[model samples]
Target: MARQHPEEPTLVELTIEEVKAMGKQGIDHPSTRPVITGGVVGAIAGAVLPVVTWPVGLFAGAAIALYTRVKR
Candidate 1:
């Protein structure tokens, strides 16, 4: 017959606020300022640019938003 060993318990170090704040930066962080700026710029550009360029600007703005969020 074999004897089994007991397992040690692990401790988690995160606080409630820190845990709540985790992964929350993507939309509301300061780093996302560029994304907001990009969106506004894209809107203005879309209004003035050709119909084809309007979509391009919007996509570019979305790219900027993703870039900022990923970089952060």
Candidate 2:
């Protein structure tokens, strides 16, 4: 009979602390600051785009927030 060893963990099981051991970090995420600025640029774009109605601007900004959150 062959001796058996314990099973190793999967990638998904690794925790943040374990990942830090690799030292694979960046200013934002291994590349630089957050790709999504999520600031005045988005705000201004959303506010200026929605022309269906005055309220559309607010809806646009809200939609941006919703989409980004979901994507994350």
Every candidate's lDDT: 0.58, 0.44
Give a tens-digit lDDT track for model 1, residues 1-72: 889988643222222233244348755755455656776778678879776476678767855664555444
Using all chains and alpha carbons, the TM-scores for the candidates as numbered come to: 0.42, 0.28
Candidate 2 shows a clash count of 0
Q: What CA RMSD would you report for each candidate?
A: 10.2, 9.3
Clash pairs detected, candidate 2: none
Off by over 4 Å in 2: 1-53
Q: Of the candidates shown, which would achieve the greatest TM-score relative to the real structure? A: 1
Q: Model 1 TM-score?
A: 0.42
lDDT, candidate 2, 1-72, per-residue tens = 999998865444443333353246544342122223433345566566665443454445554543444344
